[model samples]
Target chain A: MMAAEKDEQILAMIKSGGNPERGYRMLMDAYQLPLYRHIRRMVQSHEDADDVLQNTFLKVFRNIANFEERSSLYTWIFKIASNEAFTFIKKNNRHAAFFDKGENADELESRSVSTSQLNGEQIREMLHVAMEYLPVRQKQVFSLRYFEEMDYRQMSAVLETSEGALKASFHHAVKKIEDFIKSKNLY
Target chain B: MEDLRDELKNIGSRLDPAGKNESWDIPEGYFGEMQNMVLVQLHESKSNRPNVNLRNLRSGLYAVSGIAAMLILAFGIWFFAERSHSIDPAGIQELDQDQVYAYLEENIDEISLDMLMTDKQMESEILFDQPQSEEDWDVLLEDVDLHDLNNIF
Candidate 1:
């Protein structure tokens, strides 16, 4: 079934006066993976992503009554998830204090990467480090475009930006990431 | 996805799949457990919430009573303000000379000679304000001696 049709059924079930829990579970089952992956990419930590995703779900549950479904249900959920991820990043203060010293990158690697392949781990670390240098909005644009594979129209809905501005931001973010990789001699 | 990759290709960039070779690991059955975790958290939060109708009724009562109290306070202030203005100063300002005399006669027992002396100035005029007009002065000076005027000066 199409996601839109599924979403309509789920909305009906939840808005029905009986057995809203079933609807909520269905909603989570449909969205949890994509939402988790998006949040994980933005926050770069499993624990933080977990918190953000759970918080996102909690907000969705609380505010579903207010969700007018003006945008697609998926877009609405993504918007909440994006906002929660940004809130986590802003509250942590670690994302801002990352300098050329690579202290936070090393720390993030130790906490997040527990792999045997050191080369892939280093490349992932380099990517995260480069992403860290991006401004918050630009990084969000890049993550939504690149990692989440969100088109500009859907992204425009979730980010509340014009398609032109989002396209420009994504382009700048990619260029910046490419430059960072080149400067680090990791390209 | 094709369009995005194509656009990037036009930009001469190789951001293929955004590090597809480097994948993040998740706990086993994470998505499976996610629904249960979220449901548990939701139920716990809902249980912890105050009763919605009761909370709304309480806030409504508070808001209505607050508005009533503000109105009563405002009315009380306006009533007292109006009464104070109309009772004392307006009553006196509207009174005539005869009414003033009548009031003084009625309240004379409440007043003392010292209090009366404190108001040395005559009513409707100051006693020493060149007490007479120029006509009176001219008439008095017409009957006065030059030496008397010099002595007064």
Candidate 2:
């Protein structure tokens, strides 16, 4: 089926208070991996990312009744996932060491770490380390824009901020990451 | 440079696929475990609802118990009062009068016996000044004489 038709059918089922499992499963099947990757980048740990992903889906399930259809279902789910990620970070801000060490160790130990892969991991590590220097909202905007390739309007819906402000945040974040990468001699 | 940007964007796109078809291996019966967890939470919520209802019922029972106790107390008081009244009717009447007089004496701050005596004396003087006619005397004698006939009983 086409995207529009599928969305309409999902909306109709939701409106009729039908089994939420079907709709939720559909949503999970469609957006789980992208959201998982997005959360993984933000949180930088596989375990934490998994937890946040589950929580995001649970939140989406619980709050699907209030979805106003103002944005695409994709955007709505991303918004929920983003909020859950921020909340997780805020609650576990004291555990910053956990994020850094785990990502580094996991990247180094993985069997995929060839010389080329090492270069990619190095760049990823530099970006991840520089991400710590940026403000939380800026990091989120930067990741979504540059890494996730989300447009400004979609990000505005997710972050509940103006597009202009998102643009500025992305600009600042990119500059900070670039400076950090240059200073560290990371390509 | 534009080509590099496009290439970078393409690489970024590949970084996170919309549908990766990647599946993680879980322990056996992971879905069952998850389903069990959900069921446990559902049961908790369901059970908690009844507990709240029971709490409300307990409160209602307490209210009913209070009303019943009050009714029993009222009935006991009424029963005791009636028993006392039946035991000594004349004594109770006298006790009621004494209670009334004691209540008035305790509550009334500025009572004057002098005014009460003066009112009684004035009424007596009026009675003494009234003429005693023969017809009035005859009626009085008749009232007293008729009671003498009751001495036979």
Candidate 3:
């Protein structure tokens, strides 16, 4: 039931390469929700998140043999999910489309948060739109830290970034998000 | 790290932080559906792998076909050229002038009357067109080098 125990069991099953169907099912059961949430936050659309999540698991299954156990399985899984999210975005040029509306960042922020709902739901949607404006690494660091509550050390392992750099990136992201919130008067 | 967290806490205090429990929605039973879909995809991938030996066999067959086609084309060209330049040894045997004369005499009856008339006209022309005089003969002889006769032969 504990994450560590489950990770070890899944690792053993996958490493054995026997009863791979059971192993794969267990792997999916263990990681599916968490990985989906992570991917969903990054991609910001249910359909795209679904696709990225599936691809992340598919890549995991395909490349499970090459997993060297150098890092925790959690970190490794997040790393793969992150890479898949980034690749999907880049390949589809979603970043360009998100930014190429001929609207300034201030106007875009105002438009995104201009929903009928005036509660926390509106704020959350506004936050999501604001996230789209961050540079790639800053967004990633901020998301992992704020949403997932990941520590700098774990983030470093997953992102392969230095902890100090991740710390800097997170602060920068926070400042940007705060400035956007103030400018949009979404409060 | 604590400073970063503190700063984030301050920034998101007025706004709910982006969290997993945000109001995103998915179709009902999506994960259950995805499991089956992913398994099917994996199985299809496994099934779709090209057989190594089969691929190699196909390649070999293609290579053999290409070589055979080239050989057939080359042979056809050679056959065409050989046929165009073909000579019959029996038909090309050397003949003496007497033999030619005898053969012509044998075939004289086969010649048409018109052909005989044409031949007579040619002979008359030649006879009438003889050298006019010794001077003319000398001029013609001067134009002809007997040594060059060997070159013609």
Candidate 4:
């Protein structure tokens, strides 16, 4: 079935108070990979990503009843995942004192090689390193807009902020990253 | 705006399929495990509601027991007071002085050997017995010395 048709069927079953298991399973199957990657990028650690991914779905299960049909299920799920990611970041920022020993250039270099076709691995590493320097909100906005390809309207819904503000955050994020790259002569 | 959009697109392309082919695959059976965990929690919540109800019932029983104990205590006191009144109604009545003396006189035979011995014994008896009259008491008081009255009256 088309994704929309499937979503409608799931909603109907959920509303009827029928077993939510099948519906929840369907949602997990459909969105797990994308959601995992999104969290992985946000947290920057595989174990943390795995932990948050499970928490995200657990939240989806518990709160699915409260999901008003005002927005698409896709947007609702993404919003939940994003909130979890931001919560993780806030918790970790207190320990930023421990994490601030300059970026692991070697680790970034290794990871960037996979995407070396478009930009050299070093440049990509430079970009990622610059990303780590951004304020939490800016990094989130930048990742959602650029990597996730979420538009301002969608991002507004996920971030629960105005579209204008999201755009401004993205703008500032891009400027900072570009300046960092140029100053370091990374490209 | 177009330039910025292109730059963002370029960034997006670079970050695409992030961590692809890395060993960061989602653990096996993760979704199933999550579903099971949630189901277990939901079931626990369902059972927990009854435990709360039972706690409320226990407290209610305690309250009823306390009230019953108080009622029993109150009834015990009332029962004892009522039984005492039923057994001794005349004892509860007020008595005049003459009535008190009459009662004592009526019981005099039982109270002493002198009263039991009779008139012959009374003629030989030397123990003083006063008459129950105010005039005799005053005459007796006049014959006695003031010091003797102080000692004997």
Candidate 5:
């Protein structure tokens, strides 16, 4: 089905309140994979990403009544997921402190590459570790832009920032990540 | 924008030149199991919601009933107060003849109209009760003979 039509159908089913499980399941099936991948890129741990993803969906279900449909459902759901990610990270002070004291990428690469099955996987890990050095918003912007390849307009809706600001943040994030990879000689 | 794009392209080319490789792994049956887990939580949360609202509803009912009881009590007091205030002290009703005769027979010695009043009040009121208004005078006049009034005067 077309995206707009799918959204309307899901909303109608939920609002009808006759069979909620169908609507909720449909919503889950449609958004889960992309949201999971996005969250995984942020936290870099499968377990944490799963937890965040669950929290995001639970919130969406609980607050389904308040959804105004002002933005596209895609933007609305992603915005919830993004906020959940940041909140989870903020609440885990130990994790926050670890990221605060930036990891040594060279050491991380040397230790992690031995266990990694492929050079590509190791490079991705290195990239994830390098991402830890970025400020939180920049890292989020970079993940949405570089990894997810979302345009500034859609991102603006999700992040609730101006398109110009998102573009600027994405640009700055790219520069920072490029500098980090070069500095570490990960390439 | 162009410069940032170039930088991103360079990073992408150097790091993941062939982008077809999958780097992440998941345990078997994770996605299939996750739907059930989330749905269970959703059901649990929604089910728990009505209990809180029921508690609130109980308290609200109690408050309404309490206010109703207070209103009833207040109205009762005001009604009784107005009823008692409406009675005029001097405007006593004509007693039943049997009740009056029975009381007179029981307390014949103690119930002298003379002992209960001064002679002057008896002369002015003609041995019934004080005539405080024109209605009382009229009632007394209706019960007395013209010869008795001439004798009293």
Candidate 6:
């Protein structure tokens, strides 16, 4: 179905008195993975991602009654997901941890979570670890552009950043990840 | 995952964009379970809204304030106890000192052991329980105006 038709159906089911829970379930089904991936990348913990995603949906459900049609449903939902991740990261002190690390451990060892380590791991795993070194905003820009393949316009709507700034952040994120991986000898 | 070697080499050159890999750690079926957990949480918060909302807070405040106000008023009355308007000063002046001495000597043993009562207790007893009423002596002492001290007779 087209985006507008799907949104219409979802909204109708949710607004109907018959079974609104079913509509909520459908909404979850459609947006859960996209939101989860974004959250997991930002938090670097499966448990934290689960928390953030649940909060995102809870916020969505609580605010759905006031959803205006100014933005597409997809954009609105993504915006919520993005905001939740940022808030979760800040609340959990993930940003503080990254800043305190001073960015200098070539053989970073994290037994619980290989957040920025590349000790004999594959290039893919190293790539995952390297992305962890980015600032929260840059990491998000990179995740959306590289993995989610969101265009500049979609990213701008969700991140509420200008297209030029987002492109610059993404560029800086790519360079940082590449440098981190190579300098750590994770070739 | 696309190789970043090309991108690394091109960082100083053409600056080709790098690749992405999504092998993050997660529990099995986390997304499915997360949805159910969220729904359960929503249902729980909704059902508990009665106890969590502002209406309950307002009601609880009123009940607490009522009890506190009653206690403060009762304490204030007790703390500021004054001579009653009904006390007959002339009646007390009419008793002879010899008659009072004789009465005290005869009833000293049953006079509430006033020696053992604290000064405050003795004062309170003398202030409130000195009068005779139209009932059994003990009944008048224990009951009468004290029945629902809440009415503050």
Q: Which has the greatest lDDT?
A: 1
Q: Cα deviation of A186 in candidate 2 (Å)?
A: 2.6
What C-alpha lDDT does candidate 6 achieve relative to the native structure?
0.72
What are the TM values for chain B, all candidates? 0.40, 0.29, 0.34, 0.30, 0.32, 0.34
Q: List the residue pairs that clash in candidate 5.
A: none
Residue A27 in candidate 1, Cα distance off native in Å: 1.3
- Which digits, one per residue and each the tens of the lDDT, describe model 6 over residues A1-187? 8867888788888877478799898889888878888888788767778888899999898788788867888888988988999998788677523324323223432431344443233455556566667778888887787777777798899999999998778778777776765565544
Cα error, candidate 2, residue B78 (Å):
21
- Candidate 2, pairs of clashing residues: none
Q: Score the docking of each candidate (DockQ).
A: 0.25, 0.06, 0.20, 0.09, 0.17, 0.18
Taken over the whole model, the C-alpha lDDT of each candidate is 0.79, 0.65, 0.76, 0.69, 0.75, 0.72
Question: Fraction of native Cα contacts kept in each candidate?
Answer: 0.37, 0.00, 0.37, 0.07, 0.32, 0.41
Ranking by TM-score: 1, 5, 3, 6, 4, 2
How many Å off is the CA of A8 in candidate 2?
3.2
Q: For residues A45-99, could you state the per-residue lDDT of candidate 2 as single tens digits?
A: 6667767777786666667778889898888888988899889977987223322
Model 3 misplaced stretches (Cα beyond 4 Å): A96-117, B1-20, B50-153
RMSD of each: 10.9, 12.2, 11.1, 11.3, 11.0, 15.2
Choose 1 or 2, whichever is better by DockQ: 1
* Worst window of 10 by summed lDDT in candidate 1 chain B: B119-128
Over A7-98, each residue of candidate 3 has an lDDT whose tens digit, in order, gives 88998898897788888889898888878877776667688888988888888888888999898888899999988988987787665232
| Ranking 3 against 4 by DockQ, winner | 3
| TM-score to true structure, per model | 0.69, 0.54, 0.63, 0.57, 0.63, 0.59
Off by over 4 Å in 2: A1-4, A94-118, B1-153
State residue A47's C-alpha deviation in candidate 6, in Å: 0.9
Which sections of candidate 5 miss by over 4 Å? A94-108, A111-118, B1-22, B51-153
- Evaluated with DockQ, which candidate comes out highest? 1
